[model samples]
Target chain A: MHPTSDKFIPFITPETRHFWEGTKLGELRIQKCDSCGHKYFPPRPFCPKCSSKDISLVLCSGEAKLYSYVISHLPAPGFKPPFSIAVVELLEGPRLMSNVIGCPQTPSSLLLDMPLAVVYEKLSDEIILPLFKPTEKIV
Target chain B: MKNQKLVVIGAAETTSLGDIPHLSQVQLHADGALNALADAGLKISDVDGIATAGENPITIAQYLGIHPEWIDGTSVGGCSFMMHIRHSLSAITSGLCKTILITHGESGKSRIPPPEWPWPPRPGSYEGQFEAPFGTMGPPDLLTIPFLRYMEDYNITVEDLAMVPVIQREWAALNPKAWFKEPITVQDVLDSKMIAYPFTLFMCCPRTDGGGALVITTEERAKDLPGKEVYVLGAGESGETMLISQMQDFTTSRAFKTSANRAFLEAGIEREDVDHLMLYDAFAHLPIYGLEDLGFCERGEAPNFIRDRNTAPGGRLPVNTNGGGLSYMHSGMYGMYAMQESIRQVRKVAAAQVPDVKISVAHGIGGMFSASGTVIFSNQPN
Candidate 1:
């Protein structure tokens, strides 16, 4: 049987290139609808809320609250077992899926609504993945 | 479209329930369709409409030598078959086509190396570009994120979640075809190897090789059919955001509420009217969400309801009597199995039949709570 790979490499699309590129500069970029003032994630040209084409990329606070998370024991292409995958509610009011680093991947450690900050890791020259790390230092 | 005259005259699952290595995906579809046809005492030529998921409608048609006047390939996810049931009701009622055949088949466990057909997601697609990049593998990984939030918001303990699989396994014990017939306890579920946080191995549905099909036609045609008539009382389908993170609420499912509410309103029945229930149990959390979202129980009350044995066999509400996807068979998309069990209960021929089951409701979820479909069936024509 072929073993599942642990490495995760995302394809950069034209619509989402800006968000990925922003990670390289240690910034979290999101789309804001100029007409309706709706901020969203997974970059798109048009606003999903009001269907407004007038949208622009803006850097977010890079700070979030842990909305939910899971510690996956299954092996992936480039990931080790017991890695925590999380959905963090951004300070700018959007939610994104990412891994929680800089902390133990445990139910007791990964508390819900805990404060988190974005941290960038250079996967390759063209790719910079943004992950979350707990802001509160573990004793 | 309330109180439509459409009826389901035939329903049958594949000959084998689990682990058939010989049957290819296309062959499984044919096997299900043929079994459903035989159940209806009809021929392939009698089927004028065909609907399927996980494969192209044309491929199924051409392979089975069927020339359908209407075809629908609505591939949402596991709940695609439920959506097909809703769509077929409209098609048959609108005089678009008659004798609709909806089939589902997946070699989830036995098939090594995913099939190359159906093509991978486009690199530019939102899932491909965003969700897939963060090591989101499959349903187990994607759904746990929301479920974790649900557990926290509702103050549900891991032991409460374990009750889902434990109760379902109790029902599976009475089922001869259930994959795991042995009774499992809450401790067993908690002790099972953890796949994702809050989700142990038993909480996740077992992968199996199976398929099922349902045949629906007009009331007039159904009157002459050999099988018992299971009339479609009401049907509703709705979709939420595609991504789990984009969902407006993590604790409850909006799609499930919308679809089930619409179905109940169309059927002109109250929650008390349903005698049997089948909620797609692709994971243990699904039924908990289904119970609340479908209005059978209040939000944050489902875990308690299960612990009280309200959904187990002999309970007030008998759910997943076929053992569900957890203990029965989960061939990737598990909606079809749920539908089949609902039909069997309505016909009073299920292996673990609910006493006096006149009204049955089958609810399905696709993707990671991305889509929902609810269908209400009755033995008595309303």
Candidate 2:
């Protein structure tokens, strides 16, 4: 059996290195298209909306709303059972998949459209992951 | 081209379904192809075009001692075989090939695991960089994202979603070959172990080992064949964004609407004209989304429509009569099973046949609402 841990280390690329490093410094980095002013997640070189190559990295406020979420009871590699996997819509208008770390992984606790804030977890010296927690603790 | 009607001369699933540990994936393909050939009374030499998913068409051809003039390997997840039927129709109509064989086989349950690829996604790849890192592994994980939102947006309760499987199990009870023949109640579904939140064990399709094949040809050739001729009245396919998060709307599938609308328009019929439907039910939410997206019911009304038992056996619209993927055999891709059920219903040989079923529409979704294909079949010539 593979070792199961709660941390998942992502591969760093030239396009995503800045975003991962931003997490290390406790900043949520996203890309904004200079031409279309469209902000997006999972850092890319060009704008997915307008197909413009003129893009710049902008530090996000790290505030998001829980668009939707799932409490995964199945065992996944490097993750414990019953963890909440969420798709959070950032205030800037892009949605990204992450784990909700602070709240209980239950439907009653993880309400839809609940406000969340980004929190960084340093998995290793080279990787720092950005996960979400409720703005205030929810019972 | 509207007058150029294609027909399915033969369709057959593997000799046995669910937990066939002896056959390899390619062998399952051969099993389905040979069964379909026998069903059509045709030989390997009669097949001029071949299409398959999960396995390479060239390898299937080479293994089955077949050489084809036309081949399609459009692997867009579970709906690939549906797309194959649409593509095969065009190929046969254009004189690209005479006899087309579409095969589907998957060793989803019993196959030996292939060696893992050493390299992960390229740093810049969208899935590698964005989705996979967050432990977004497979359909169960990815599809739940949209489904959760859909439930919240529409005020759909978990009980409403459970009704989909409950009603499907009723149809499965009548199907002798259905993997889960015993009936289940809505409470049974809600109590089933949770795989993902809002998706219990019963709400998800079970992994099985099986294969299916379809033999298609021009209407003229179908007339010469002895089997009940199920005409391909219309066919349409479309795709949207690949990732679940990138979808334009979480409440509905744009691909399902586009593909099904095109199919209905091409068939020159409205939703009321159809007597039967086979919306792929890999997950319970698919049919809910499909019913609404395909215009069977209004948006946010699918849960009610299903809850009212409109899709159950003996209902106004009989859906998944051969027990859907929820209760039937789902060998990875489920489009072929849905296609087989539609053909059976049209031929009037289904285990739970609907009365006076003239037009049956089969719709398929692939890659978590990423791609869609809709094929409408009828017993009457259009």
Best by TM-score: 1
Q: Whose DockQ is greatest here?
A: 1
**Native contacts recovered, in order, as a fraction for each?**
0.69, 0.63
Task: Give model 2's DockQ, 2 decimals.
Answer: 0.57
**Model 1, DockQ value?**
0.66
* Error of model 2, residue B176, in angstroms: 0.4
Per residue, candidate 1 scores C-alpha lDDT tens digits across A1-139 of: 1223335556677888898779878888999999999998878899989999999988998899999978999776567789887889999999988889998888888999999999987666667778899999865
Q: What is the TM-score of chain A in candidate 1?
A: 0.92
Give the TM-scores of the predictions, in the order they appear. 0.96, 0.95
DockQ of each: 0.66, 0.57
- Report model 1's TM-score to 2 decimal places: 0.96
Per-residue lDDT for B129-211 in model 2, tens only?
66665666677877767898989888989999999999999999999999999989889999999999989999999989999
